[model samples]
Target: MLIMKPRILNGMMICGTESEMRYCDIGELHKDFHLGTNTTIDFIMDQYDSGFLLELCRRTAQIVYKDIYQQLQQGNSAVLIEHLQYYLDREGGVFDIKTVQDEISVNVSKCPMLSHITSNGETLSPNIGDFLSDFYGSWGENTPFIISVDYTYPEESYCIYIRRYYAS
Candidate 1:
């Protein structure tokens, strides 16, 4: 059961699959295909726990960090922020960033995935916290500057994504 908003966003064709796939403008890879929030969460819950997801993300992020860590340092830490924005924006997520001294504060008013799922009547999985936190923690692995991340769960307000980096 794909739960889609009444409107579909802009997207190009995705080739090379068992069948041809179509992407919603606001999806990550295949995260938001024809499915809405509840369906996706149910799918995730069926497959893995929050800790498992976090460990998966941790190992994945570590690999990605190792491969691009040096390239990221070659220019600016803001590059990582830009990439983050790019992925989230792809799904029409709302986020704001404030930078002062060496810290980056990201306020996520509406997350494209979790928030979207919640909107569609899905209760968040218990493992969701581990998934979010460890994913952020993995970014600390290989940085030219020491980086610390703090994540706040979305409550009455929303979750916050904060990154503190030692500036070179």
Candidate 2:
């Protein structure tokens, strides 16, 4: 039996067949529309259009990496130290700010499709790792293909969104 996997990160959701995964950014496109980044984009494709969604995912990453990667590369000791301090304070994983920055330096096409098979009526919620564990069933023997980011917004309700890409 084939298994299914899904990964979400950084406000992007990529899913669908292995051969042709679809990536999307519902929130970014919404903001882009309001900002008139491209007035003609709407006439070309609506939110439901997978192509439009994928484009948003690609474009958003371009914007993010371009804006942040270089600043990290500058070796501005103060800024890097500040970020390192914050990560350490939070008990996050050990990571060098510059190294992390380098991961997202180049564009990557990370797909977020939740599973390999969509049979039955079982639609896995993005929050359920158990549902996705199937993709990693071989004790990490197989290539790691899916991941998710869990975040809590201070003073706001809990929400789970698939992080579409990982810099690492």
Candidate 3:
């Protein structure tokens, strides 16, 4: 049997992979984080009082991005979780990706995402729901998070990828 690729998969281009790409849409995304109440960016700019929300969103994005980037570099699940937790525990109004790398370093663990979910949650099942739940619980109502990881092997047995999207 032969398999084809999807139009979009994990922020990558898969012309001839083992199978089609899969995408999972997480609703509401960062709405709980309170990016905006009812007004749009135009209104915020006109009012000249949207700095707070904007700052929060920017910081949130930076934190999430840096965390994931570092996690990937470490290549270890436990270290990734610990590193993220450390960042979350820190006190900083502005989010800076460079700062995260400076503070701590841990051994790289394969599949850092799984490690993150495992440490945050007591039990982790193969089900994606379990991972989502763990993420939601860890980030809390104020923290916004998004992730996208692609693993493909056209010549291998199969391809596996995970993606996370964040919005406020």
Give a tens-digit lDDT track for model 2, residues 1-168: 112244565645543223222222222222222223223333334434535534554444333333222332342223323332332323322332222431211111121222111222234332223222221121111112112223221111111211123247
The candidate that wins on lDDT is: 1
Writing each residue's lDDT as its tens digit, candidate 3 over 1-168 gives 233343445766433424221222222234222222223333444565445444544454335544543444344233334334343323111222222431222221233333343444423332233222333223323322223222221111111222222453
Q: Best candidate, TM-score-wise?
A: 1
In the range 1-168, model 1's lDDT, one tens digit per residue, is: 123343433444322212111222332455544234334434566786555665666676666554335444453555456556655666677888787776666666667777655665656654455555566656655554444444454441244444445555
Better of 1 and 3 by TM-score: 1
TM-score of each: 0.59, 0.20, 0.19
Measured by TM-score, how close is model 1 to the native structure? 0.59
TM-score of 3: 0.19
- Estimate the Cα RMSD of every predicted model relative to the unseen true structure: 9.1, 18.4, 19.8
Where does candidate 3 clash, by residue pair? 74-108, 75-108, 75-109, 76-108, 76-109, 147-164
Q: Lowest summed lDDT over 10 consecutive residues: which window, candidate 2?
A: 102-111
